[model samples]
Target: MSGFITALFDPTMPFVRNAALAGFLSSILFGILGSVVTVKRIAGLAGAISHAVLGGIGMALFLSVRGIVPGLPPIVGALIFAVIAAALIGVVSLKAKQREDTVINAIWAIGMSLGVLFIAKTPGYADPMSYMFGNILLVGGRELVLLAILDLVAIALVLAFYPQIEASAFDEEFATTRGVPVQAVFLAILTVTAVAVVLLQTFVGIVMVIAMLTLPAGTAGYVARNLAGMMVGATVLSWLFSFAGLALSWELDLPTGALVVTIAGAAFLGVAAVRGLKALAKRAGRRAEGRVAGQEAGR
Candidate 1:
């Protein structure tokens, strides 16, 4: 037992150690962005962005397989295309003058279809399942560096613009009336969300990314009365889920992304149940009090 434990903790255990760290950092970053995404009522938009990355990943794989961009990294290509898609979504939604959900649905469909078609056409491209589900075990130093920089930028942006984000999220027109540059703030938030989606795609893939971004935050929101408390609680919950999921996946040989999302979903359900029970209890108490008051009045 001692020997096995020693081997498991050895520095030679490359993938497990590195993957654990990557998962931890990724969870923290995603949790923060997820809080903002939920509060802004743009959770659907975040989902759209995550799915849209499939198109970017497909395009990058095609270019690389064809040797058209032999020197360019697929991730770099994917990130570039994802950002462009995000910008286009922003521009179109602003110009369409239609319901935001309608515009987002159109963009989501188009992006996903393009990605599937591109992947179907590309020869020698790796399995699409890997992109859809993620490959955390394959994380390297380069990816970790990228994650670190993006995480720092995300944290800094949240800190610097907390008040503006709070105002805009709760009331856009009021924020604008207060000279908060609502449009600019919206654009900036969307851009950050897009980048975060792309980063999370590398770990959990598009299908599961939305769960990572929303579930923890959603659960946290139930117990949190303020933005700061919500963010902190969500981050803590996300980290717990991520670490537990990773460990469970390792022990059971289950899919890591699926396990992570499953844990988060369970947490969400648990929180909802607790909240519902409390609400029911409160209503019961009110009814009981009202009945007692009526009996006393009659007496």
Candidate 2:
């Protein structure tokens, strides 16, 4: 721990500072989007989008290496693939409810397959695991700037459309009946989530990043009174998990993305277990009270 702190403060290691910033910024997106995604019960949809980004990343790498599109950034390609994936999923969800699972699964598998093929055909050795399980400690200045911009944009959008988002999230049918444009809102959610998936994938790795997205929000759900409260709680938890995971991974030489997700998963599961036990205790107490009342009446 001391070593990690020392390294973090060392003037020579700017990347460490960038990485910490990245975690903080990434947590903001994870918290806001995760809350809505959880409420909407679209984690599966978000997961598909997260994995689909690999296809764009792979394509960008291939193009850049081949000089077909020299210096093509992976994020740009990832955005394209993620947006397309989201659009398809949104249509299937809204129009073909019965085929939603099938479509989601197809996109998940096909996107990954395409990515693998592209990486394989690239001239040089490009390890897919590097992209799939990114090292946050290596985050650069460009990424941090982009992340800040995304954070601002997301916050503004959320502030501007909270009512519509809240209405559409909980009860789509009711929201639609009330003239909420649920379809547009749903598609917009998917699109925003997809773009976030693209950006965060490069830093956190798409393989298990969904865990970070959902786990924090899921944990917050236990105690949060409302969606806004849940978002605030989730954001705090996400940042804590990210920082703790980053520190532990640095100290122990483990994968930062996996570490972050694991910590979040543990915390979420612990909270859930405690809540379940509390509920059971309440029910047991109620049953005991009823039995005691019955015995006293008979007596």
Candidate 3:
């Protein structure tokens, strides 16, 4: 921990600061978009898109090496793929002609498979592990800038469309009857989330990114009474998890992304378990009171 802090100012290790900044900026996205995702119950859709991005990453790497789309950044491919996947899933879900899960699973399977295959066929061995589980040290200044930009955009969009977003989130059908353009709003939400997924994939990798997205908001659900409140609380928690994960992982010589997700997962499960216990105890107390009342009435 101390070494990591020292390195943050060492000037020789700029990546440390970038990693820290990545957590700070990205917590905003995780909080805002993640809250909507939780309320909308679209984590599965989010998950599919996150995983599906690997296909784009793989394709970009393969193409770049072959001089077809030469020097293409993997993130560009990821963004393209994620947005397309989100649109496809959104359209199918909106139409309701077929089961949405089937499409989601199909994308998830195909995207991941394509990524693996592309990486395998690349000029040299391309390790899928980094994209699968990110390295905090590899996070660059450009990515940090991108995360900051995404944070601003997400906040601005949420602020501008809070009413419609809230209405659509809690009850899409009701929002539609109220002339909210529910379908458009839904598609917009998915699209923005897709973009965030592309950036966040750099933070926690594709597989674990979804965990951070859902966990912070899931924990916030215990306290937040509204979507806005959930966003605020979850953002704080996400930052906390991200920062702590960086510090501890640095100190322990562990994987940063995995450590971050583990922290989030632990916190979320702990909150949930405590809430469950309290609810169970309340129910038990009510049952006991009910029995006593029944005995008193009979007597």
Q: All models: lDDT? A: 0.80, 0.90, 0.90
lDDT by residue for model 3 (254-286), tens: 998989999999999999999999999999999
TM-score for model 2?
Answer: 0.96
Instruction: Quote each prediction's TM-score.
Output: 0.92, 0.96, 0.97
Model 1 residue 259 CA deviation (Å) reads 0.2
Clashing pairs in 2: none
Clashes of each: 0, 0, 0
- Candidate 1: 10-residue stretch with minimal lDDT: 1-10
lDDT of 3 at 170: 85
Once model 1 is optimally superposed onto the true structure by TM-score, how far is the C-alpha of residue 3 displaced, in angstroms? 11
Ranking by TM-score: 3, 2, 1
Cα lDDT, model 3, residue 149: 88
Instruction: Pick the winner on lDDT between candidates 2 and 3.
Output: 3
Please give, for residues 16-66, the per-residue lDDT of candidate 1 as tens digits. 766777877787776788888899888888877777777787777777777
Lowest lDDT 10-mer window, candidate 2?
Answer: 204-213
Compute the lDDT of residue 93 as modeled in candidate 1: 65
